[model samples]
Target: MNCRTSLSSWQALTTSSERLKKQHLKTLFDSDSGRFDKFSRHIPGVLFDFSKQLIDDSTFEQLVSLAKESDLAAWRDKMFAGEKINFTEDRAVLHVALRNRANTPILVDGTNVTEQVQSELEKMKGFSERVRSGEWQGYTGKSVKDVVAIGVGGSNLGPQMVTEALSAYADNTLNVHYVSNVDGVQLAQVLKKVEAETTLFVISSKTFTTSETMNNARSSVNWFLESAQDKSAIAKHFVAVSTNLEKTREFGIADENVFTMWDWVGGRFSLWSAIGLPIALYLGYDKFVEVLEGAFEVDEHFKTAEFEQNVPLIMALLSVWNTSFLGHTSQAILPYDQALHMLPAYLQQGEMESNGKHVTFDGQTVPYTTVPIIWGMTGINGQHAFYQCLHQGNVIVPADFIASVEPQVALGKHHDVLLSNFLAQTEAMMAGVNEEQVRNDLQSKGKSEEEINELVAHKIHKGNRPTTSIVLDKVDAKAVGRLIAMYEHKIFCQGIILSVCSFDQWGVELGKGLANNIEAELTEENVAYEHDSSTAGLIAYYKQKRNK
Candidate 1:
């Protein structure tokens, strides 16, 4: 057994798991009238209710002990202090420094990164203001009406998720389009909507060399040059959020138009940096500032709140309890608000990419499951789609149900109806109908005993599926920032508890390197690399068919 599993808290939780497996959440609620009050917490704009999670007071205390034994607080302090905690890369994990609204000086390599973040924020403000106010012009001297954000993975997911979440607040100042897949169809479809002469492209790649991002950037520039008919015009239309100024210069973007990125900020956690330029462009810079402020609030709470009361830490502990102790292998992200429809996809990348490793920080294979298979959709759509599996399927998936108290659009009773479903689903999942309850209901409805018996098994839902409920004030810019920040901190704490290095994604890098080598084999003649027989046969068939 590893050191983590050997901890007193870990052993206690493991010993208690068998009892927890048989205990019903409905029974827990029935025994404690104040269960919700004891289990739920509230911050400024959000209410985090973990009352439905499959745990008792003793279990909760044990989970908190696990966090303490794991040294979560020390790790969090090291990250905030800009120490090189991402030891594999020898870089500091300092996404929190990007939203240091209090302007506290955080140094990395003897230079204050907090000041650097502020400088970049100011630059984003100035540039986004210019674009939104019609001061920034394209090659044709016309104000940019559309913004095309090109990038993949972190660059694409974070900004696009935020923009889509707060899209109702967009002022129609600019229509932002995202092209992440190098599949050509996405970019082709986006390009068809706007004239090249009036559109601005913001290409985001840390090195200006990511394959999908660069390919999409090159194709966009080609389309722009076809219309502008001048190589110099590229400077007026294209901007970049990257550190590689030489590559941006060669690609025809001016030095001033190239924003900055730092090594300390991992791409999955980089939206607070200049990676959020497209967010600022789509929704004015002030709204962007609100996003930062919202995140800063959670950062302060995570830094100061007690472990039992801290929402993010509790989130991490619940996840650990569910996956590591209880043996639940997957969790669902079900948002009742339509504005947060992309939240599942965003978090899938955030959580899975960060903690989807089998090895611990010391390279020991972990005995426990590290991260859950994170998946889900917007609540209404998922109700029709996969809630069947969630409700009746044997695999008991824990879920987070998110909804806002107020709707962004506010049309009549839509918000109430939406919230009603959100409230009812969690209740139904907790207090599922037994065979007796189903039979009683069918008999009350005047169904024959035979009919009731036939339908009873089909309709019977064995409840006790665990879920957490998060209620936001509204799905505005600041709330979106808070929601995402909460999850980000949860992922960080989870990695610490699980003994995995969340900051380094060596898995993603390996696949990227492999794809780069394979690209040459596909495009260049007489350039074949050895592969397994299956892969070799597939490639040979593709090349043979293409030649014909």
Candidate 2:
């Protein structure tokens, strides 16, 4: 693979900061009456309205051309066909196959991976049914009443986010808990809630050797054994989603209890794979299937839909327009529903970890930015937090406003208030308060001329901030699945547009490797290791204080 370093026209447009500064989203909308029809896309129960963004038809056309120049279609096909598109690891990026509802045959090596996916899904269904129906019992002959999922990164975030999003749909037969943080506080908190005898642990690690995951797994095992009273009982209570059967056996999980994860699946995209065991355990197997089916629907749309009509492609192009053409440095994922509170964090890892690269596929430095710093909280909470900056900040920040028409928890007028805020924020962002409006409002309040001038300056909002509103009919298992897959595909498209590999994450490895060495040093009290000046000083200070 040769390094590609040429800037796309979209990149060229954004290179001129002065040009971007002069363009306003409000002007873009005002100048075009069909802007909403041109920019918005709908598929199934989801509506993505990007008309409030700063881009016009010509800009969008240029983005489509950029996608063509990047050969996005070819890359998309390569991924679906199970080709070795993940160049860094020499693996096929085939998480799409995890939800292959068409049951299409996909091959990795000579093996039909679709068959393996189906088999694993069947295993998950059977296990989920037994556990949810009280047919699966622990060594103590008690039906499992709680689940503790132990994984890090993609393993943890995807399932945890989905389970939380679909919490209203949960049968409540068993309580589902997730432990991802390496901090002992996370594990200790979970241990205090569930009885170890009736708790089942789902350990998810592709290699079964992720340092944080394994450390947490070890702590969880110890916590379980404290109640079970026998190390042998670990086999009955602990299950694994990993291909490393040897490591799982060594860790005391029975062979039958060990599920499989494939190299074709990337961690962030593995929720559709066996990593979704926690989701199924929480919402029953049928709803879990609904999630997969929903994702498959998006998969079909992404694979078959044209560039102009494609929801994911439009989203990807709009992001490029915002970050590369409009000079926006960060993108916000603002979900109105409380159940989807983790979405921003989940997408932060999904988008940033995937496409936050400086280099293209062939090791050449990219001429433009790849991924924006994606961050946000739930919508109502954000209004009280950093929304002031979003409304009147010096820089333009593109935001995605997600809300459901129907609330999951209909607490009287709470949902209406939430929805009103959601609708009003986007409207305010698009149509900011002009100096005249501010002055008039001040005058109407009987302010003096000088006082009105002072207040107007602070009240005048440059309301051309770009935002996309994603309104879902509801947030069920299927809706959550479609929503997540929409972003996943959008991330993929953004990577393709930026000429970077979306599937590989070598960036996360450096810290994990260093942490292992640091952990060894801490445990052994080996203070002789060379380190950065800041780190050395900290370790020295800690060791001296401990010795005192």
Candidate 3:
């Protein structure tokens, strides 16, 4: 389970990959006329075309065998049954329960958690309705006009991405802003756009103690009181989505204004929980429920569909085959729609935070690569920025090309142009230009023999890059929901297949703890402590320069 053992296991799979690589995609397509029919999966309104990936019938059968050997079905059942599969945190990974529309009985510690989830959702609906309908007024007797969501990491990313993706469905009655960075610039720009009397701040943190969020909350409170001149007005303008009722009350938010966040829900997967209050307030409660229903559909598909037909499962298996078995170290998420600009960042956190582990479930080091480095931009933007590297770079990076069959905003010929580029990129990547084609094209362009030789050498593309294209019917609230759920379940399956706990993120804690200690050292004026030479010299230099 150590690094050496993991590397060896991964190395063993390369021989099979090399053999498969020798068989060109053109040959495979010619051999199987129904390649697309055999490789594509249709789930509701989503079409997943994985035919362009570097995979065949034998490769897929082997992946299914790996899933069975890893006991994926049992682990999946344990997760849905409310067992504490996140052993490190000793909590059940039950984000699925948040979208349980069936009201099925799910228990944690002998208490029916399904009831609790339903109750909280009803509460959110009531609150969101009142606020969005102009019934919830500020202390100055004006309806709220703006909502500012304050949270960091998962608390911030998921809702932000969803809201941005489904912006077309937004009611436009109220504007929504999000602040997650500790930097002053983010809050300063947002604060300048709204007045204290009509703005509502939803402070979201599980513990109500995140340093950046609390700091921004304090600064906002100070700015509000300066204008309203009544400290108690904080209760009217600020609400909290947290479990710490004591801290919420102390911060001048009423008990009724404080929503609840359970320990079983993780931040990244919490948009379906109370963390989605901003999303509901911006896009009405009914649209938000549609989002939940969309995800529930994906959840049902994941639970009941066969492995070969399941979209999330197949996506996960493809990722494993590429990263762990084929030695690809990076993955690209290329969304062709411009509205989904933040999706790459959202998936980056979802995948890396969940599966970026070196150890396994039995407290042993893993004997294979865990997670690939996830990075990308919007499809059209990336075509100009990094697609050059993907097409011609030394390392082969697997990519996901996402686009919609119907454009969200259709102008004159713009959507067609965008769709054409989306289709062309994948086709070009799969069937790259060969030497013969390059030479023939150069000759047709009237180039001399010497010029043809030089240009053909540079222009010949070593095709065979692997890519999967996801086509949604449209970019509505429902489609965005299905898209997000697809990737969420994909990360979950990859973690289970790799024999690692995907819910816990202890790696992020170490850095936060170190920052706290460093803050104390930096602020102390008369600090007399033993330090390493490098640290001591840096501190002395800063202090001396500041005194001048």
Which candidate wins on TM-score?
A: 1
Query: Residue by residue across 304-379, what tens digits does model 2's lDDT show?
Result: 9998889998898888777765567899999999999999999999999999888877788877777899999998
Better by TM-score, candidate 3 or 2: 2
- Score residue 60 of candidate 2 by CA lDDT: 70
Off by over 4 Å in 3: 1-15, 524-548
lDDT of 1 by residue, 1-548 (tens): 33499899999999888889989999999999999999999999999999999999999999999999999999999999999999989999999998889999999999998888989999999999988888888877899999999999999999999999989989898899999999999999999999987899999999999999999999998998889999999999999999999999999999999999999999999998999999999988889889999999999999999999999999999999999888899999999988889899999999999999888888899888999999999999999999999999999999999999888997999888888899999999999999999999999999999999799999999999999999999898889889999999999999999999998898999999989988999899788788999988988899899889
TM-scores for all candidates: the values are: 0.99, 0.96, 0.96
Q: Candidate 1: which pairs clash?
A: none
The local distance difference test score of each candidate is: 0.93, 0.88, 0.88
Arranged by TM-score with the best first, the candidates are 1, 2, 3
Clashing pairs in 3: none
TM-score of 3: 0.96
**Model 1 clash tally, residue pairs:** 0
Cα-based RMSD of the predictions, in order? 0.9, 1.8, 2.3
